[model samples]
Target chain A: MPTFNKYVQIEDKPSMVPAGLEKAITAAAAKDTRIIAVLEDMGFPGMLWFKKNCPERMIECGIAEQNAAVMAAGLAAEGFIPIINSFLFADVGRAYNQIRQSILVDRFNVKFIGREGAWGEPGISHNTIEGIGSTRPLPNLVILNPADAVEAEKAAEAMLQYVGPVLLRQESSPPPIKIFSDDLPFDIGKAFSLKEGRDATIIATGYMLTEAVRALDILEKDGLNVGLLDMCTIKPLDDKAIIKAAEKTGAIVTAENGTVIGGLGDGVAAVLAENLPTPIVKIGIEDEFSQSGKMSPKDELKEHFGLRPEDIAVSVKECISKKEKLRKKRK
Target chain B: MAHHEKLVKDLEKKANQIRRDCFEIFGSTQMGHAGGTMSIIELITALYFHHMKFDPKNVDWPERDRLVLSKAHCCEAIYAALVELGVYPRKTLGTYYCFGSPFQGHADRWCTPGIDYSGGSLGQGLSFAIGMALAEKMKSVVKDVNIGQGGFLQRYVVRFDPLYRSYCILGDGECHEGMIWEAAMFAAKYKLDNLIAIIDYNKFSLDGPTNEIMNVEPLVEKWKSFGWWVTEVDGHDIRQILDALELASKLYGDYRPKCIIAHTIKGHGIPAWEREHIHLGRGAVIMKGIEEGRKKYADV
Candidate 1:
């Protein structure tokens, strides 16, 4: 197994994301009076904390995601930094045109906290895997999907500090184990390399990073040395880090909790095809809707979608063999 | 005539001039949103020239009242008014709809000055206007009060009065969008009296008559049900529009949003244009309308 770096401090206990988001936003709003909370009908876990602490800053838009989207645009125009929170399908999907025409066209300063991923009981309606692909093409919008609690808090703080449009995805997997140390040095458009290997490298984003951490162990047991990279900022993908990983390993496997169509896999594939031409395999949900599944000892959805550590280990071996075949042909 | 009468007479002449200018700009492009633009001449003229608070030189002054044109398709009227107020050069009117022109087909705040919100999509402006109005209520102007005792200075915070209002103009056909009612309920729930919305009830949308396409009849009851202080006026009459605006502004402290349904006809001013429900007049037909408009409104 590759040795974990200083940035990797995987704790034993798992923590919920809503608590982390609440802490970060509460700290940011305490100092900046311009920050306001604009929420839809389905409130987050600690939404009442905001209403209790800063009642004047809370705005209830009530089931009308379209109205809330345009209303936040208006509030942003008047210098109030409004943060809208909802499910990805409701906030970004139901109001896609409003976000594009009203918000992105003028590039309003609005923050969206969209929660969507797989392996939950809400099923396809709430847990859509298309948010990443759908929002990728919109101009002037930065998309961030943090891997764990520490990274989530840092991404939220960074999103608040930046003065433009940003969408932070809180993936809906069983809560990820606390993975990063407190002082991880997070930036908007950079990636963090967790381990280095010669055989192959696995680039992971969102909750899939935790699975990749486990996949590294599985590969090591099978006598293959693999590297791990945490890709938090999906947009403005860190070309240097991706190219370095490609150059070192010559084979790549991309992992995400969503679709492979336009998610992190496509982004990495395009980067490799244009720059390095490395052997790559994308690991994500196929072209179909997600259904209800359990996350117990078996983890039914992960098993069904082939997103377990065993699945990732299989893909890694396949990628490495592709690289070995290419070398043999050249010789 | 009395002084008030003279003021009304002057505003009427200004309205006539604004109508003629809209026709001339439409003729320059040989095509434009002639019906809705013509219908809102008196309402737009009353707001920019006679009612709203703005500086032609400093367009982004924080305290200045804002105009959120939700039905941005009829941007020619706003452009003509901006030119009249010296916000843009008169020559800019000739470049309407051309590339790199500030007079975009829609009312974009980034491209054009004197525009508060960028709008091309319908049913979004009222919500945007409500946002500005809510923000204005929350905005504060800070003043430092010095309490000096033994050469020691202390500061105190005091509340400032409301400085500006947000005026939004929407089209009757645009009411078909469900987002309009969503905004309507929101403004009422917040009791945003600082937001004023005026509807240009010109009886037509893009396809055909609004009633035949999708009837929005019983419109007044709809606004009243949505909790707005509603009123009706002749959109073409300068006195009526001015009086309604003045009344709406006076009700600011009453804590209720206002909606004025100004009844109007498609292609209102020129007889040749008014005979047909022409949403976008073009070429020979618009030229004929311009020829007729010059005879009626040029000298005045």
Candidate 2:
């Protein structure tokens, strides 16, 4: 196991992803009785709140993830919107076939809440980094990775408003800093520009958006202006935003708390490579399976994975230099 | 009970016709699941012709009872039955498995009419049926408040008659999947009395015999242990199947789901094809022999 001394201390924030999701579901259930929440063996604190509000709609489906997925599809088939809650590895990884066949193929109105991302300390088994990659190829699935509790709540409500299958990935650890205001306009398949710059663009998603903001601050201190874009929706990607970013800033660096292979980085790169060939650098876990061991602090893990602010600054500088070299070669 | 004999005879004739139609369809396609399709002819007939309430004109009627063919590969029997009921055109049967045809090899609700759920992957329909049953249970409760001048007359009337039931036909081989047992535990725990599951215990699977491949024996006891009202019957006998279904329907709202283990042969109608481990591709050869004027069975 690798270790690092550099640790980014997260503030003691009270808001959490599960709490926000539960609050959103409870509020939505009051308006629409068709909303049903199905739980696996994993206990969600939101279940109690939902049960207290809508007692008859709670379905405790035990530890069987496969059955839970298909049961949700069946409920959706009968015009009831079912939200299934489970760990990311268990729900999206284990019951992938059921989600693909029964839910996505039929376009059933089902919502899946996959808790715990690459930031959790419960070891690699509980920490899921490839959920977005695994579910990205499935047709008719809307994938959302919320940056913080506020975005999580908004994403939950947005999923309810949408009428098809959705996979909303919720991080296990809460972010110390708030990224979005209370009145931020959130929509599916849309990207939000946090900061504008012309030198290079740092497009990030999920928890990495916080790190991207910090990196942008670091670059600004050096008098380098770097643009920052928060991509919440992975599938049905905001191609227009990405193309605009690439055209405005000739260099791009994609960051995500997932694997670099088929996650947000590859998704952005695929569009940019086809639309406009820009010099891009990806910042995420390389091609390897993460291990389970002693828990490390979030900052140390970021340093260990080369995901710190300084590391991102280094990649952004490299991307800018690469773009310069390509320009000179063209001349 | 005097008219029971006539009902049984009529159902038997319909089942025989469906079996013949299934074999002919498979013969024409030269590739289809005839064994399992033939095994569930009587059960399908009993449900579509006698027990289940469905309107051929309106396939999406909310009050109509739903049937999910969990053994989806055996869709020929369902297609034949639908054609007989006029839900699908008679000429569509000839276009089975052809390009751009509505009649696919598997039971896809998106492609064909009267199919409640799409099923090609097994071990999923039971859970889907439980979902529909749960929906019906939740929708059936009606809160009626009639306020008079003196006081308010509030009555909670649960109309079970209008509430539709969900029936699923599963294959014995499909039970080998772990999802089936997971669904079973869930259905029993919720006490979904509106859901009924009928397993076509045809003994043979795609590769070989179910017992030799993977024995799912003591099926009745297993269902009983899972807290289901278990019943065993001769699947080919229309009266026994109908009686089991009727008993299952009567047990609605009892807080316990029903399971009927129907013991049946692999190739029920044709004696020559019986005892053979027949699947999709294997049926075309036997069907070809029948079409080539090889009369192996006098009755067929």
DockQ of predicted model 2: 0.36
lDDT for each candidate structure = 0.86, 0.80
- Residue ranges of candidate 2 with Cα displaced over 4 Å: A1-15, A173-176, A292-298, B1-3, B142-162, B282-286, B289-300
Q: State the lDDT of candidate 1 residue by residue for B1-300, as single tens digits.
A: 122887788888887877777876887788988888889988998888878888889999998888999989888889998988899998888888889999888889888878888888888999999888878766752433332221111122233325788989999999999999999988887767788999999998889898789999899999999889999999998888888998888877666899999999888878877887788888988888888888988788
**Native-to-model Cα distance after best TM-score fit, residue A175 in candidate 2, in Å:** 2.0
Model 2 CAPRI quality: acceptable
For all candidates, the clash counts are 0, 1
In Å, residue B153's CA in model 1 sits off its true spot by: 34
Winning candidate number (TM-score) = 1
Q: Give the interface RMSD of candidate 1.
A: 10.5
Overall local distance difference test of candidate 2: 0.80
Worst 10 residues of 2 chain B by lDDT: B147-156
**Candidate 2 clashes between residue pairs 3 or more apart in a chain or in different chains:** A8-A299
DockQ of each: 0.36, 0.36
Candidate 1, A256: how far from true, in Å? Answer: 1.0
lDDT of 2 by residue, A97-162 (tens): 888777887899999888755655577787768888888999999999888777788999999999
